[model samples]
Target chain A: MQIAILSGKGGAGKTLVAVNLVNLINLSTYIDCDVEEPNGKLYFSSEYNKKDINVLVPKINYKKCTHCNKCVDFCRYNALIDFLGKVKLLPSLCHSCGGCKLVCEFDAITEVKEPIGYIYQGDYKYHQIYGGELKIGKESGIEIISQLISKADKEKINIIDCPPGNGCSVMESIEQADYCILVSEPTIFGLENLKLVHELTTLYNKNIGLIINKANDYNNIIEDFAKTKDISIIGYIPFDKELAKLNSNQQLVSDNNKFKPYFIKIIEQIKQEVDL
Target chain B: MIIALPTKESGEKAFVSENLGRANYFYLYDTKTKEGKSFKNNFLNELHGAGVKTAEFLLKYSTDILITPRIGEKALEILLETDINIYKSTEKIARENINDFLNDNLEKLY
Candidate 1:
């Protein structure tokens, strides 16, 4: 079964939950969908095999001779600007929708591939792992993520560490996943953002469970929220200083026995839900 | 006037491109008639998506100046040639402080 770990906001310990879950599961393929800032690879210290991926952008051939404004008018992204009877092509704004190419009577427009980001594949002892990294100053993070997930070895069970926020990246990561684990803190902002993520999951019609990180004084609030939403509280990890210290030293949560039980419990719950 | 604010979030500081290192927002404030508006954009995402070759969505709105914390060489060069005044300031809310700079109520923060 494919499981997607996500949070509506950043720095909400999604990666922490993802890495630990991967280590606890019997065997699973791991994917880091946060192309902008993929820190999941840091947990396993796995050597990644890098591969570049490209996105197609529109290229105009001026030699085709017709200076008709049809191409400009057809572009919804304002990628084509017609000024003084001259057409200017803005490749960046181009979503490569092929509308301009399709509209141009004279075959003046064609698609050209542009480098966007890289996908890194590696192994964490038993699990095959893949993550994506968007080139600095590059857009289309969701595109990179989609490509990376497509390349995931489907033969094995998958765990996707989703990008933060309820934007395009998060949507692409969990698009077709079998289940979703919404990792959140116990604060008010955490609950609010978790609700946003829950709403998104409901929209996708995906089964979801919650993992409350830093479980402390806010347990009652979290439990109440879970009960009202009918979302299962899979597991909770207490605020542990040793876990924080290990993380600061670049150690995985699985390396600490104190945190292993929480991960194991979540893994067991996921297996039961998915009937794995 | 329409001003550009390079922001980490939606609303924040208006940074000047020529000065400062890291600014939350690159705000574009109009000094002519005491009317100020900020254009908040995700600078990292914009730069990543467009690669500084073209100013499509960025230059769509009308603006006289682009106040940013720090703009890369490519974006700065492109915006400078477009006849836009690029100012550098550390002040977060430059619209409120335009009068301060004019009246000497605020010194150049950067």
Candidate 2:
């Protein structure tokens, strides 16, 4: 089963649940779809085989080209600019739609692969972990996430740690999952944002359940909201200083003998829900 | 010549906006008539290529020059395709800057 762990807002324990759950579950493959800031790999030590993720961009051959300005007018992105009777290519603005290539009569335009980010494939013991790292200043993380999802082994259980927010990147991650683990905190802000995640899961018709992290004095607020939304409460991880200390040191509570049983219990409940 | 100045407000008393793509408004001043108008820059919130979109928007005014704090390389390339020239605005009110521009006191930004 492919499971995606996501949260509408940041700092609500998405990484915490994803990493620990991946460690708890057997025969699991972990994918960190948070390309902008992927910290799930920090919890486990593994050497990554990095590969560049490239996108097709236009390259112009001005020798055989006439200054017809067709490609310039055809480009909706304004990637092809008219420069003194010649066409100038701005690769940054190009969406690689191949409109310029189609409009060119002289066959002056050609597509070239440009690197947008890097994907790291690493192994944690017998299981596997994949992390996508988008180059800074590049706003396209959905492409990398799409590439990551395509590389998933359908035979093994997949655990995806998605980026925060309800943007296209998060949608791309959740779309590939058979089940969703919606993690949230016990605050008004958390509840408000959880409503967005809940609506998204319902809209997509994906099997989803809620896991409340940092469940301290505000448990009633989260539970009440989940009850109203008709979303099942899978489990809760308390706001413990010891766990916080271990997390600060880049360690997983699931790796600890004492906390392993708690995660196992949650996994057992999830396996039954997913009909595994 | 119609000159476009990035401004925070929609009037002569407005200070110049620092960034062209993210400016609140573009104040247009006609050198011959000394009349001014303001256009709300709707491209400020765009995730990408706001500069190019803003430059495309300025084409409607037949603007002869642009006076802003700075323009990006992409925006400069786009604006150069038209007749609009770029000039850097200094620490002065919008009205005074327009006067300085008309009097040829401001330096061309190229």
Candidate 3:
């Protein structure tokens, strides 16, 4: 079963939950799909086989051009602009639709592969982990996330750490899940964003449960909201100073006897729901 | 020579729009004939490349000068390549700014 851990807002402990879950499960494959700032790799000590994630972008061959300006008019992205009586192409703005190549009877435009990110595969303890990191300034990483999820070991249990927010990358990561775990903190902002995530998950028609991280005085806010929304509150990790310090030191708190049961309970809940 | 003025409205009362891409309308004034015509900036609502597309649209007028508040790099690049001179608009009023540019009172951007 493929399980995705996601949050509507960043720094809400989605990585904490996902990393802990993988450590506790021991046999599941962990895929970190947060390409923009993937921190899940920090918690694991493993050697990875790296692969570059590439996307096609248009390149102009001025030698083959007739200066007809058809490609400039055909480009919706404004990547091709009429410059100094010649057509100039901006690689960053090009979406690689191949429209310029199609419209150009002179065959001036051709597609070229551009590296957007890299995917890394390695094992952490007994479980395999896959992570993607986008090159700085790259706008999109859905393609990398999609490829990573597709390459998952279907027979083994998979836990995916999805990117934050309701953007395209988050949607792409969570869409392939057999079940979803929505992580949120105990704050008004957290509650509001969690509600948005809940609505999106419902739209996808997936079985979703909530994990309340940093549970403190603000627990009632999330508790009441989850009760009203009919969402199952699976686990709660209280705001503990020791746990935070341990996390900062790259220690797995799930290995501690005190915190192991909470993660184990979550696993039991999953096992009951799934045939794992 | 034609002068391109960024405007919020279509008539003589039109004020200069602060943003070139989001301008509601563009007033094209023919300096030789002393006649002005206004057209809606159709690319105003576009999500991306509005500035570049707006510059491309302005190309049809064969404008010799542009009077506006500010222009970004992408738009400036396109405008410079087309040999259109850019003049910064100090006044909020479109006609007054155009007069300043035509009278060599406003500062040229490039």
Task: Give me the runs in candidate 1 sitting further than 4 Å from their true place.
Answer: A82-86, B1-110
- In TM-score terms, candidate 3 sits at 0.81
State each model's CA lDDT, in order. 0.71, 0.86, 0.86
Give the per-residue lDDT digits (tens) of candidate 1, residues A1-276: 678999887877888888877787767788999988888888776788988888887777888938878987677665566533457765556676778888888988888898888899998889888998988866468778888779656666788999888887889899979899998888888888998999999999999989888889878877889999999989888898988778767677786777788888888888778865
Q: Which candidate would rank higher by TM-score, 1 or 2?
A: 2
Q: Rank the candidates by lDDT, best first.
A: 2, 3, 1
Residue B26 lDDT in candidate 2: 91
- State the weakest 10-residue window (summed lDDT) of model 3 chain A: A83-92
The TM-score values for the models, in the order shown, are 0.74, 0.84, 0.81
Provide i-RMS per model in Å.
Answer: 6.3, 4.0, 2.3
Candidate 3 Cα misplacement greater than 4 A, ranges: A45-50, A61-76, A82-85, A103-108, A121-123, A135-137, A244-251, A255-258, B1-5, B11-14, B27-38, B58-73, B76-91, B95-110
The candidate scoring highest on TM-score is 2
Query: Could you tell which candidate, 2 or 3, scores higher by DockQ?
Result: 3
DockQ values of all predictions: 0.08, 0.24, 0.32
In model 1, state the lDDT of residue A199: 91
Clash pairs of candidate 3? none
